[model samples]
Target: MAAVKLPTQRLYGTSFTCQISERNKDPPVGDEVWGTLVKEFSDVPDASAITRITVRLVIAAVLGGVLGFERESKGRSAGLRTHMLVAVGAALFVLGPLQSGMQIGDLSRVLQGVVQGIGFLGAGAIIIRSAQREVEGLTTAASIWATAAIGVMAGLGMEVTAVLSTAIVLVILAAVPHILPTPSETDSKSIGDD
Candidate 1:
């Protein structure tokens, strides 16, 4: 007999099963097409998913925008769009596995990945001037890190928590500065920029 072909194989020491099938790659027709495109967004059908996806994403964006407004008012490089994108991106990272039915325990990996990825982005905001012995963007970097955490909270459906946290962050970014003592004339030049 001719050699039989198996639908499964072991690759990279992991055995996997594979199925060959054809799917309709073409777009759907009529009313079905509309639902097919937006079922996940419809109020009646996918209400829960809508809450998870749309509500969370919007909350993330608004909160991020608030943070961005503060940074932008101060003429920081990482402003509104940057912060909003970071918040929304962080929320999506959590939302994807959540919509896929992954257990809460499995989400730790996703959270870790988001934090590490945001760290790289925050690092970009930092500026170290060795000759001038000045460190800049610390506050901006910290804000990005905190914004990601807030996004994660929003994505987890903690809307109230997200709002409260946003309020607290706004206070830290805005009120705390005015309340703090000003830098001395000698310290002004070397003071870290936001």
Candidate 2:
């Protein structure tokens, strides 16, 4: 008797399971495809001090969420939830080192690496569609970077600073746009218009 072939599993992120069947690879019979499927998975971290990590994640989420809320209110592409998740994830990543209480050299290097690493994400947020006709996401990109910073701060147990920074971020997000001048008009005219 022949053994049955098992479906392949694809892991997503770090805990979700995604099963891919052989049939899914079959070529489309017609120009119009019916049900295209893709598997997604993430690995959930298993640890004793899950609660502590969870707390850090939540704090980072809240900090990012605060900024995300501002963006959402303005109808930006990356909104509250996206920001929250990014911040929280970054915070948790930082917590691993912090909780272990590792060497000073390792910790310092990790800190620098974290800042440098977030740049990739920030870069993704910023895109110039055209040379003269540039469309920028400066605010959103900056918010993402700030969110990461807040996560690091939270991971370091700077809870008060995290919370205060979140609040200040919200306030600045709200007030800055209103006070800034429009690009179409001259500086004096723009201020006057405001």
Candidate 3:
């Protein structure tokens, strides 16, 4: 990687540098767009890397779907697609940097970012109604967080770990209900008060 100084822009007094490669100084348009497409698909010269990435991504999706399918059957709001997207997105977050030659040690930052970002996404699923004293979507939010972790494991080539983790999550989401009622169910139990 060659160091080439480029232009920087400041927003809110913070500088952001954008690099334009020599080949991309003038991006292709119209008929030449195919070249860009080919370049992207061919970015990874190693055939093994392509297969590795593809398998990992597919595994992540399947594991995520397993969790999502259960939630969808239970009529949860963040169902199949949400869980699948979260998993695939998390997998890409890890895959992209590693494919770009980033070391595993450097991945701590990436993992941290994924966890923080997923937390916000999970937060969106939670709703607290002060008037009713009822909180909803806590389980769905937690499921999304767990799904992200599963995706990360898949991305790191720990497919067995990801599969095992999914099994545990499934047991929690499916089997554990017999022993313990969820927050929403607990709230419903108190509906007699209302």
Candidate 4:
């Protein structure tokens, strides 16, 4: 009995099993078709993957910048570059698992780590003005947290969600102060009455 040989090809550094009959000198039309399809679909060039990653990073950075710009306009210490870096870093954290082909469950762990890490950074932004009995930078810290979330959405390929979230954030940051008076303003109003 003649032993049948199977053709194999490498994809992403892994070989795919190809079954073909030995009776024919050439591979069957189906095998040839399959081989061509595999080469076309499975052999993604590294440059293409890099481009996708770069795009995601850029989207994350832009979304973060939008929020950062609003905070910077208010003269907050943690402004454009800080928010951009936070968003880019968070997106990369999510992207790492995706590029490695990690399962969703594993990806959740990475996301959890990203959130926890951002919490520490947000904490750094918060300051208690004990003499004035006031807390400052809370809004800036919250914006930082939200920027990270936008990055996560962008990295997960939810560009619409990221954009919408950023829009809502900008609206809140820009409009809320005008809608409600600040503590100092209220205090001054009361002092003027006295």
Candidate 5:
């Protein structure tokens, strides 16, 4: 009896024969694009995939900037650049793990690391004045944490969620302060009555 031959699949314009002997063979040389920084493990990304990645990164930065702008306008310590960096860093962290062939279960661990790392950065922004019984930079720290989350969403390809979250964060930063009294304001009011 004769064995039937199986069809081969083409990758990067090279035919990958499905023979058991060929399974361990390396991919053909000259198959990679010369200038791309990212190397695809399973398959090369076409122009569309590259464009999508670029778009996601840009969106992440812009959304982060929007939140950063709000913080900057309020004269916060962790302003535009800090927030933007956090977002971009978070996006890259997720993107790198994904591009490196990490499974979905493994990806969750990467995200957890991002959250925990961002928490440390956020903690650094906080200041407590014992004598004045005042806390500063809490809002800024919270914003930084939020910006990281926006970046994570962008990295996960959730563009709409990232954008909408940015808008909502901006609204909270801009409007909520006016609706609520600051610690100083409350203290002053109480002192004046006394």
Candidate 6:
């Protein structure tokens, strides 16, 4: 039986979705899991053609680098090198078992493992300034997750979708927040009435 490809299904059905992590025993934040799940598909690209390991690495690195460029431009912690490695490493990981024809417990487990692993990298991108009660880097971490997905898109030969998605992601990350009104502004009148 074939493994479920979460992002492909989710993307087609809904703009957003969520999943629970059995290991963590909690519902993971939807956006983060969605991004990582996309990255995990770096295994075979499509089932039709076998990919060369070297080519996979190049695609992962280059695709990751391009997405990472946008993150680095914003001075994110998980910039070029980190993004590049995550993608290339994921490609290598999925390729290993499949190329060898090893009977693994559904490909989805491999993908789940990828998500569990990337969580460590994502955690590092977040920073808490206890003194000032300020937190940062969540979006940067999300971007890293997204960069990995781009690599999978490249690995799978979905080049146009990958490129278009990357552009859309960049615009949303860079511009959307700036145009939206802050929650504080919307709630100010409520407080004044008290």
lDDT of each: 0.86, 0.71, 0.88, 0.85, 0.82, 0.68
Across residues 1-194, which tens digit of lDDT does each residue of candidate 5 receive? 33445699989999976644443354544444532324434343677877877887898899899899888987888889998899989998988888778997989989999999999999998887667665778888889999999999998899999999998999888987788776577664222110
lDDT (tens digit, per residue) of candidate 6 on 45-102: 6645454556666877877777677778877777888888888777666666566575
Q: Write the per-residue lDDT of candidate 2 for residues 20-110, one digit (tens) a residue.
A: 4666655766522433221111123456466666677788887888899988888776788878877876776677776666765688778
| TM of each candidate vs. truth | 0.75, 0.64, 0.75, 0.72, 0.73, 0.59
Model 6 misplaced regions, further than 4 Å? 1-52, 102-105, 181-194
Q: What is the number of backbone collisions in each predicted candidate, taken in the order shown? A: 0, 8, 0, 0, 0, 1
RMSD to the native, candidate 6? 25.0
Question: What is the Å distance of residue 30 in model 1 from its true position?
Answer: 10
Rank ordering of all candidates by lDDT, starting from the highest: 3, 1, 4, 5, 2, 6
Worst 10 residues of 2 by lDDT: 35-44
**Model 5 TM-score?**
0.73
Candidate 3 has what TM-score? 0.75
Tens-digit lDDT string for candidate 1 (70-121): 9999998899999999999999898889877899999999999999999999
- Model 3, residue pairs in steric clash: none
Mark the 10 consecutive residues where model 5 has the least summed lDDT. Answer: 185-194
Clashing pairs in 5: none
Give the higher-lDDT candidate: 1 or 4. Answer: 1
